[model samples]
Target: MKRLTITTLLAVAILSGCSSTEEVVPDVPPAELYVTAQQALQSGSWTTAIERLETLDSRYPFGAYSEQVQLDLIYAYYKNDDLALGEATIARFNRLNPAHEKSDWVLYMRGLTQMAQDRSFMHDIFSIDRHDRDPEPARKAFRDFKRLLDRYPNSQYAADAKARMIFIKNRLADYDLATVDFYIRREAWIAAINRSQQIQKLYPDTQAARKSLPLMLTAYEKLGLQEPIENTKKLIALNPVN
Candidate 1:
C-alpha cells in the first residue's frame, strides 16, 4: 500500500508538470484575430491592437492576411507610442516589400513616425525650445520625407510631407543658432561667427539666416574683425528682417 501511494504521487506530479508546459490559450483564427485588432485600432485601444496584431503576425506568417497585418502592426506600434518598435516594424516592411505598390505611403508613414517621435511634451506643451533637445529624430524625418518626395513626387502625401520637411528644416536651423548663441556666450568669437555663417549658407531664406547675420556681426565686433563686420552689415542690409 505504501509503494502504491508513492507511485500515485509521482504520477500526479508528472501530469502537473506536463499541464504547465501546455499552452493556456488556444490559437485564435487568423481572420478573427485581424478583425479584433482592427476593431481595437478603430476604438483607439492601441495596446490591445498591438497584442492582437502581433499574435496574428506570428501565427500567420504566411497566411492570406500577412501583408496587411505587417502594415497594421506598424500603425499600431506608432499609435501606441512605441517609437522604437514602430521604427523597427517600418524597417522590416521596407526590407520585405521594397517594391510594394503602396511603397510611397509606407515611406510617408515612416517619416511621420519619426516626426512624432521627435515631439516632446516639454517642447510642445511647456513651450521649451526644441533646440535644447536632440535633433536626430527631426533630421531623420527630414531625410525620410525627402526620399519619399524624390521617389514619388506625385504621391498623395507629397504636399503634406513637403510642409513637414520645411518645419523640420526651420527647427534644425534654430538648433544651429542655439549652438552659435552658446559659443557667443562663452566668448568664443571665432566659433560663434563660423557657426552663424554656416547657418546662413546652409539654410538660406530661413529666419535663422536672417537672425544669424546679426549674431555674426556681434561676434566680429567682439573680435574687432573689421572686414567680417562690414560684410555682415552688408548682408543684413540685403536681407529683410522678418
Candidate 2:
C-alpha cells in the first residue's frame, strides 16, 4: 500500500516489465538466465540481476531455478530500491510456495524491504528530524519481523530481526514523543500532558520516556499543576537515561 498496489497485478508487472528500458527476451534458457542473474548479483548490479531473474520467471514458470530466481529477484529489487516490486514478489512467492523451506528467509527479506522503504537520500545527508515522518513503514517492518520470529524462532535471521524490532520500538516511541512536543509547542498543556503520560506508560524503558519526563514536567508547570510537576520531576530523577 505504501509504494504500489500490493496485488497480483503488481506481481505480474514485476515479472513482465520491471525495467522500462531493458527488454528481456524469453528465448533464453532458464539455466543460462539463472547463471547470468547470479553473476549480476555477485557483481552488485541489481538492475541486471532483476532483468535476468524476471525473464527466467516469465519464460520458464516451472523451471529448475524458479524458486531461487524469485528469491534473487526480491533481493535485487531491494538493492535497487524497488521496494514495491520486492514486496509484491515476496507475496507471490509466499502464495505459490506456502511451506517452502526458504520461507523464513523470505519473511526476513519482507521485513528488510519494508524497513528500507520511504527513506530519502536527502534526509540522510541533512540533519533532519524524521520523527515527524509517517511511522507506517516501521510498523509494517515490526509486524513482518514479529511474524518471522513467531513462526520460525530458530531462523538464521532471528537475531537481526530482534535487533530491528528494538529499533522499531524506539522509532514508535520517538514518534509519540514528537506528537507530545507538537502539543507542547502549541501551548496545549492538557494535550501534551496526556500524550507525555501515555509515552511514559507505553515506553517507560525507552529514551523517549526519559525525554518525555521533562516535557511532561514542563506541561504540568505550564498548567500550574504543582503536584504533577513534582511527580514528573521524580520520574526524571528515577529514570536516568544511560
Candidate 3:
C-alpha cells in the first residue's frame, strides 16, 4: 500500500512539472506578443526582443503587426550581432514587400550588414586584380548603397550611402595598393607596375592612385626603362603631395 502511494505521488509531481514547462509559452494573442517585444526593445533587452519578435513574426505572418514584427526582428538581429540572420531577414523582407515604402531603409540596413563583415588582414597575400579577388563585403556594401541612391535619389538614407560609397572606393584602392606593395617586396617590378597602373586607371581620384605613381616610377627605374620612367615622373609631378 505504501509503495503504491509513493509511486502515485511521484507520477503526479512529474506530470505537474511537465504541465508548467508546457505552459511557459502558451498561445498568446498577437497583441500580447507585440507588446512584449516592444517592451523588450524599449528596455534594451535585445535577446528578449529577438525571441518575442521572432515568435510574433512566425505566429502571425499575416497579422496586423506582421510587417512591423519583421522590421523589429531585423533590427534585433543586427543589435545582437547576428549579422547573417539580419541579412537573411533583410532579404526576406525585400522579397515579400518589393514595393514597401520603407524599402530604402531596408537597403540601408543591408549595406550596414554587409559592411559589418570581417575586414582583418588576410593570412594569404592578395596578388590578383581587385575585380578578380574574392568579392569583399566592402564592395557589396558599396553596391548596395549605390542601389539605394539610384533607386531613391531623394531618400533620407542617400547622403549616408554616398559617404559610405566613397569610403569603400578608397578602401578598394588601398587593397589594390597592398598588392602593389607585395609585388614590390617580391622584386616583381613588372607585376608591381601593372597593379599600380591599374590602380590609377580604375581609381583615378583615390589617394592610393597618387601614392602608386611614385612606386610605378621606382619600378620603371629598376627595369632601366627610360621613357616609361620619364612619363611616370611627369605624372607624379602633375599630382604632388599636398
Best by lDDT: 2
Worst 10 residues of 1 by lDDT: 17-26
Q: What lDDT would each prediction earn against the true structure?
A: 0.85, 0.87, 0.84
User: lDDT tens string, model 3, 1-242?
Assistant: 98798678768867875774321444788898889889999898887888888887777788899898888888888777689999999999999999999999999999988876634223212333343244488889999999999999999999999999998888888889888988888989999999999999988999999999998888999999999999989999998755
Model 1 lDDT tens row, 30-72: 8787888899999998877888888887887888988898898
Q: Tell me how far candidate 2 lies from the true structure as C-alpha RMSD in angstroms.
A: 7.7
All candidates: CA RMSD (Å): 13.2, 7.7, 12.9
State the number of backbone clashes in model 3: 0
* Best-to-worst ranking by TM-score: 2, 1, 3
Worst lDDT window (10 residues) for model 2? 1-10
In model 1, the number of clashes is 0
TM-score of each: 0.85, 0.86, 0.80
Model 3 TM-score on a 0 to 1 scale? 0.80
